[model samples]
Target: MKKHIFLFAIVCITQFIYSQNDNIPEKKTQKGFGKIDFLSIKMPETTIPNESNMGFTGIHYNLMMNDWSYAGLGIYGAVTGERGGFFTLGINAGIKKYFTNNFYLDTGFHFGGGGGKSAPDGGGAFILPHFNLGYNFKDLSINSGWSYVNFFDGGEIKGHQLNVGLEIPLDFSYADYDVAENDYSFDGLQKSNWNVNSKKSSLMLHLNNLEIKGDDTNKNVQNFGRATIRLAGFEIASYLSKNWFTFVKFDGAYDGIKAGYMDVFLGGGYHLPFNKNRTNILAKFGVGAGGGGGVDSQGGFLIYPDISIEQKIFDAFFISVNKGYVMSPNSHFYTSSYGLGLKYYVERNGIISDENSFSEGIFKGIEVITKQDLYFNAKRDGEPTEDMHQISVQINFDLNKNLYIAGQTSFANFGNAGAYAEGIVGLGMQTNPFINDKTSFFAQVLGGAAGGGDISTGEGFIVKPSAGFNYQLNNTLSLRTAAGYVKAKGGDLSSPFINLGIKYNLSFLKMN
Candidate 1:
C-alpha cells in the first residue's frame, strides 16, 4: 500500500535524525515504557476480501522490563482502498535476545479486537504470531518481521511489516526506584497495575457509544438522538480516592427526525477492588439534563451502574472497558452503552514526576490553546467534499500537572453552504514525547452543542474526538496539528478534520 511506503520512509528519516544526535549518550536502560508510533503495510498474494494491500498506522507502547523482555500494546487504524478499513486495538507479549549492543531479535503473539463499519471481516477479530529483528539507536529503533494472522471468520492472512518509532521512557531504574526485578514480571508487563488505592487521584477523558436497547420506542428514540452510530461525546472522570470518584459527562448525538440531543451529568460513585487489586468494580450514578427538542425536552435524570475492569499496561497508563445500562425511568427511556477509555493516574500523596522527562516546571499552570481547522467530507451522499474553516479558543483549568479540564468555543464558516459554531468542555491529558520537553502529546474528546452554522437544514449538536502532538516554539507558545472526526445530530453528514493551531502556556503562580 502507498501508506506503508510512506511509513517506511519515515523510519529512514528518523534514523537519519537519530544518527545526527550522536553527541548524546546511548540510552540503554533495563526497565522503561517507550511510547512508539508506527506505520506499516501488508501485501498478501492470496487476495482475500480486504487483504490485498492493507496499510495500518497507529501508536505502539512497550513496557520493557529489561533488555531481554517486553510487553506491547497498540491502537491502530487500517484501510484498504478496495476493501474498506477498521480500528484495531491489540496487545502482545514477547522476549528479546540481544546478540550485540545494537542488534536483537523479538518474537511475540498479538490478540485484539476490530470493529466499525470499515471492519467488514466479521468485526476483524484476530490473533497474530510474529517475529522480527531490531537495531536500537540511542533513542530510536527499527524492527521488521513476518506475522501470521488468524481471524475468527475463518480468514487467514500472512504479512510482514517494519516498525520505526521513537521510544517513550519508563525508567524505574533511576533514583528511589525500589521495584525488585523479580517483582516486575519477565513474561512482559501485566495487563494492568491492579492497585486502586495505590494512587489517590485519577483523571480520564474518553469517547463512548450509546446503543439504545428495547424495541418499544425505536421511532421516538430516533426522534431524540442517534439510535446507532453515535460518534458522540466524551466523559471526564475525577477519581477523588481509590474507592471514590466523580464525573462530568456530556453527550451530543443525532436525533434522526430533527437536530436534537444534548446531555450533561454530574455524579459520583463507589469502587470495589477484587483480584488482589488488579481489577476494580465501580458504580457511578449521575443526574443531568438532556435538552434538545426545544426547552421542554430538558431536565432529565439518569441512573446507571457501570462495572469496569482496569489493568495497567505500563506505569500510570492503563486501559478500561465497561458496559452499562442506562434509563430515565420517568422519561420512559432505556439505553445501553459500552465504553473504552485510556486513563492516567496522578497520586494524592505527592506531585507526579518523571525524572527521565523534562523538568515538571516546564509544564503546568493555566494554559490556553487556539486552533483553526479545515474540515473535509462535510457533505452528505453523492456530493463532493466541502471545505469548511473554523477557529476556536480553549481555556484549560489546571487541577494538577498531568490532568485538567479544557473548555472551548468555536466559530465556523461554511461559505454559502451555511455557518456553524459551538462551545465545548472536556477533560485532557498531556505527556512529553521526548526528554527535551519541547514536544508534547495531547489526546482529548470534546462534546458540545453546534448551532448557527449550516442552519438551513436546522442546527444540530456536535461531538469531536481528536489527538495530536505539540512542538513548543518557546516557553510560552507552541505549534500543534491535530486530526479528529466530527459527527453531527440529525444530519448524517460527518467529516474528518485536521486542525492547526498555536497555544500559550502561562505559569501565573507557583505550586508547591
Candidate 2:
C-alpha cells in the first residue's frame, strides 16, 4: 500500500508540472527587471469573440526571486453577468522568464478546478495551464495568453485572453538603468512616477452611506432594504508619487440596523491634480476582507473601487466628497458609499523610522493572532449540558486591517449528545478593545465537520459562530471571554457556548 501511494504521488506531481509548461522552451536570455507586485485583468475569448460569455478577472502578486526566474501567487476568477457564477475562483502558482528588455514568457497552473456548471467528472481531478506572452513599459504591461483546463472525463475549457496589468514598483534607485539611452529618466521610470520632493503624510476622515444590492437567479434569492454605514474611517497613507498614493484605513460603521462594526482596508490610487496642486481629483482601487456586523461574525471579501475630489482650503487642511462600492463576494452584494469628509496633511522630510510605532502595533494591533479558550455548552438535545469544559485554539489571519479569516478546532465531551471534536473555517472582524489599548474585540462565522463523539449522530456538519473580547494584563498573558452558537445538522441549535481562558499573545524575536 505504501509503495502504491508513493507511486501515485509521484505521478500526480509529474502531471501537475507537465500541464504548466510542456511546450515552452528552456532557453535562457537577458535578465531584465527586478521584483514587483502586479494586478492583471483578462478579457476572455479575446481571439474568438463568440465565446465572450465566460470572462476572466484576476489579481496577482509576483516577485523576482532570482536573476533568471520569477515567482507569483495569483487569485483570479471566471464568470459573466447573467450566466456563470463569479465565485468560481482560482489560486495559481506561476513562473516567468524575461528574455530581454520588457519582454517575457510565462506559464501558470491551478489545481483547484470547477469553474462553472457541474460535470460528470468533478473538476477536482482537473489541472490547468495558463500561458502568456507580455511586454512591459514602465509600470504597465499588456499581454496575450491562453489557458486550458482539462478534466478527467475528457471535458475541457480553453480560452484566449487579452490583459492589461499594473506593476507596483519595489525599488526607488535611479542608477539601475541606462537613463541616457533608454530615456527611462530614473531607473526605468517615467517622469510621472517620480516621488514628490516635499514628502508628506495625510489622514482622510470619511463618512458615507452603504447601500447593498444583489440577486440570485438560480433559486430566486433576493435581499433588500438592507443598509450599512460608512459612519467614519481614517486613512493613514503616504504618497508614492505626486500622482499616486497607498492607504491603510480603519473604520467604524453600523451594520444595517445593528450597533456598530469595524473594518480595515489597504488601497492605492491616483490624484489628478489641478490649480498647481491646490485641488485634485482622485480614484482608488483595491481589495479587502472584513467581518463582525452581526451575531454570526462571518467575514466578507471586499472590492473597493471609488472616486473622489479634494480641494485644499487651508495650508494643511482639505475637504473631499467620495463615492464608491464595497463589493462583497460571500454576501453576493455591494455596499455603495458616498459622503463628504475632511483631510489633514503633515509634511515630513522623510518617512517615519522610529521603533516606537512598531512597538505600538504589537500592543494595539497584530497582523496575525492565535487564541485558546475553555468553555461550556449551553444545552444538548434540549437539555442543559453539564460542566462541558472544552479546549479550542484558533489561528486568525488579518485580511485587511479590520477583517480576518479564522480557522479553529475544539475538543468537547462527545459522549453526551454533543460532538467530541470539530474543525472550522470562517470570516470575521475585530476591534481594538481600547481600554487604554489593553483590550480587543472580535467575531466570526465558521462551518465544518462535527462528529466522532460516542453519542454524535453518525457524522454531522456544524456551523459554529462566535463573538469575543480580550483584555491584556501583561506581555505574555491576557484574559478572554466569548459567546458562541453551534448549529449542528438536523436543526440542532441547542449548543450555544460561553468560554473563559487565559490567552498567550505569541511573538517572535527579531534581530536588529
Candidate 3:
C-alpha cells in the first residue's frame, strides 16, 4: 500500500510539471514586426515673417514604408497682398520603402498653383525623392530625412526634415497575449479584455488646409443652391494626438471684389469633456482664418476660428454646434447652426469567434438643429444681400449597425416673403457591419417635400434614391461612389446624379 501511494504522488507531480510547461510562452525564432509604422515629422520652425509675405510653420507626417504609400485629395487657398492675392489648389500622392533598419527611401508628387491677376498665375506638378534614417527605441523614435523636389515648370526646391516622437501602447499586451495563447480561451481558464483607458498620441509637421461642404434649396421661386470652398494655402500644422491639435492655417480666395493679398491665422484648442467615455465632446475654439470668401471681405482675421460642440446624448442621439464662416466667391459670412443627430447600431459582430460565439448588437440615435447667418451676405452676381436665416432638423437610425434609415426636415425664412419647408427621408445599408469600421456598400433612398404657402395647393414633392459603395482604403480615409434617380410630383422633372467623393474621419470629438 505504501509503494502504491508513493507511485501515485510521483505521477501527480509529473502532470503538474507538464501543465506549467504548457502555459509558458513559446520562444519564436523569427518574431515578425509590424510593417506599418507611424512616423512623426517636425515642421520648419523659422518663418519669413511679414504681414504681406505669408510664412508657414508646423509639424507634418510622412506615412510611407516597405513599398507602401498614401495620398490625400483635398483643396487649399490663401490671400496675401494689399489689393490682390493668389490661390492654389491640388492633390498629393507619395510612396516609400525601407531597405534596412534606420534606412529608407521615399517619393511623392503634388500638383497645384495660384496667384493674383498680375502675379504668377499657373499650375504645375512636383516630384520629390527623399531618404530617411532613424532609430526606434521601444516606444520612442527619432527620425530625419532630406528630399529633392522637382517641379514640372523646371523649378527645384531642396529641403530637409527631422522629427522626434513617441508611441504609447494603448492596449493590454499581457492580457492580449494570454488570450491569443489560449486560442480565445474557450476553456474559461483565461479572459480576453481591452484597455479602454489607453491613450494614443502623436505630433507631426506638414502642409494642410480647411474645407467644408453643404447644399440649400428654397421653394418660393423654385431655387436651389450648392457651394464648396477650400481655405488655407500651404501652411504648417502641429497635430497632437486625437484629443488636442492646432494649426497655423492661411487663406487666399480671389473673387474680383475683395482681391487683396496676405491672410494668415494661428490658434488651437482642447476637447471639451462632456461624455464619460470621451467618445463625444465639443471641439471648441480653433482661432484661424474664419470661414467665408472674397479677398478682403472675409471675416476678421482675428477672432474668426468659430466655436462648436458635438455630443452623443445616447447611443442613437447626437447634437452639435455647427457654426463658423462658409466661404464663397461673394463675401464672408457667419453661420450659427444647432442641431440634433442620431445613429443606430444594427447587427454588430457578425464574425464568429473561435469559441463559436458571435458578438452582435444594434444601435440607434437622432439630432435636431437650427442655423442662422449673422452679419454675412449672400452674393447674387458679386453683390451682397441681407443676413440669411435657416433652421433644420435631421434624424438617423441604424437597423443592425449594417442597415440604416435617415430623415430630415428644414424650414428656411430668407426674410423676403421666401419662407419654405423641406422634408427628406432616406434608407441605407452597409456591406460590412461594425462600429467605426469600414463597409463596402452604402445604398440609400430619398424623398423630399418643397413649396411655399399652405401644405395643400402649392405643395411639391421630390423623390430620389441613391446606391453607393465605399471602400475604406485605410483607417483615416475612404473612397466612395454613388448614383441615384430623382423624380418630382409638381413639376415634370427627373434626372440622375453620380458622385465620387472621399470622406475623412477627423478627431473623434466628445459630447456633454
Candidate 4:
C-alpha cells in the first residue's frame, strides 16, 4: 500500500509540475491580515475506559485570502483529565459569514494525529468539526459554539462539546521575490519601495545538556535517573523594542533520555549590545508545558529561565552559548542546563497600515508546507506490521536560489497507534524549474526525535531521506509530493512512506 502511494505521489507530482503552459499568467499578489486564535473545548464522559471528561487548549494561525477565506495550522493539547501530554497538530480551513453589525458565524474543521497517557486514540487520527457565533470589535473577536471531536481511525474516544475561542488579527504581506525585484521601484537605499520599517526577527537552533536536580530526592527525577540528558530544539524571536523581544521555544530529548520527552516555552527576553555592536548579552524568562517519557511534569506545566551571550559571525548570522534552569512549578522536574546555538536574523516584509500590509523586496524566500504522509508495513512494539498515516507541517528557509534549511513537526493520524509524533530538522536542495518553468526537482535528509504510539523507535532518534518535485500553481501556492524512507537509529521501527503537500511561498524582507 505504501509503495503504491509513493508511486502515485511521484506520478502526480511529475504531472502537475510539468503541465504548465508556456504563457503562464502574471501573478497578482494581495495584502491581508493573518490571525491567531486561542480556543478551549470540553468533553463529557468520553475518555476511553475511564469515562472522564477532558479539557483541551488550542492555538492556531491562519492566512486570510482576498475573499476572506483562510487556511492554516493548529495544535491542541489536553490540559485536564490526566491527559497532559496528549496533543494534536494539523491543518485547518474555513470562512466567516458576516451578518449585521459586528456579528458573524465562524465555521471550520480540524484533522490531525496525536494521543498520549494511554488514551485510546487508536492510530491518533482525529477530526474536529465546529461552528461559532462571534462578535468582532476592532481587531479582536470572541465566540462560542458547538464542536464534535472524534478519533475515527480506530478509537473509542468521541464526543460533542461546547467550544470557546478568541481571535487576534495580525499584519501579513507577500510577493514573489523575483517578481518584486523586477517590478517594484527601488529607493535610495537599494531597498524596494514596498519595504516597511519593522523590527527584525530571529530563528535559532540549540543543543542542550541538562543535569537533573536532586535525582535521588525527587521521585520524578529518580525514575529517569541522575544522568544528564541531551536535547535539540529551536527558538523563534520577534522584537517588541530595541532591547526587548518575545520568543517561542520547543525542545525534544534525543540522547541519554527517552524520545517522548519534549517541552515548549513562551517567554520574553532582553538583549544588551556591546563590543562595537558585535556582541550581545541576553536574559530570558519563559513558562509553558511539557511531559511524557515517564517524567511527571504536573499536567505538563513548566517554567524556564536562561542567560546567554551572542556574537555576530557573518551577515545576519550569529553564534551563542547559554545556561538555563528548567523546573515544573507544580512538580519535581528540575534541571540546570547549558547549550550552544546558531542564530539567523530574518527580515520582516511589508509596510504596516490601518487596513493592510504591503512589502516588496528581493530577499530570501520562505516556504510553508502542510503534508499528509502514508507509511507502509510500519513496526510497533508487541504489535504486527500495519500501515500508518501522519500529518506534518514543514518550513523551509532559502539559503540561496537552490538550497534551504528545513524543519518539520509530524503527528500520527491513523494505523492503530496513537500518541506518535516526530520533530525533524535538515537541509535540502532543489533544481531549477523545467517544462515551461513549472516544475522543479528536490531532495532532502532529516533527522530528529521520534517515539510514542508504542512504535519501536528506541531512544527516539530517527532519520528520513526523500526526493520529489514541486508544481508551481501561482506566485504564492504550489503542489508538492515526495517518496521517502524512515528508519530508527536505535530501535526496530522502519518504513517506506509517501507524502502529499501544498506549499505557500513568501519573503521576509530586511527592515527598511
> Which regions of candidate 3 fall more than 4 Å away from where they truly are?
1-91, 95-105, 111-190, 193-283, 287-292, 295-312, 316-318, 321-512
Candidates ranked, most accurate by lDDT first: 4, 1, 2, 3
What lDDT is reached at residue 151 by model 1? 47
lDDT of each: 0.52, 0.47, 0.34, 0.75
Q: Please, what is the TM-score per model?
A: 0.39, 0.38, 0.37, 0.85
Q: Count the backbone clashes (under 3 Å) in each candidate.
A: 14, 4, 47, 3
Ten contiguous residues minimizing lDDT sum, candidate 1: 173-182
Per-residue lDDT over 68-152 for candidate 4, one digit per residue giving the tens place of the 0 to 100 score: 5777788776654556567688878888778867998989898888877667788898898889898988778888888888888
| Top lDDT model | 4
Residue pairs of candidate 4 with colliding backbone atoms: 123-417, 125-413, 350-359
TM-score quality measure for candidate 2: 0.38
- lDDT string, candidate 1, 390-469, tens digits: 55667675656556677665544232222234556677877734657578788888765554323322345667888888
Please estimate how well model 1 matches the true structure, expressed as its whole-model Cα lDDT: 0.52
Tens digits of per-residue lDDT, candidate 3, 362-477, equal 11222111122111232222223333222333333443445665554433223221222334566677565244545567677766443221111112455667777665666435
- Runs off by more than 4 Å, candidate 4: 1-52, 177-192, 214-217, 350-361
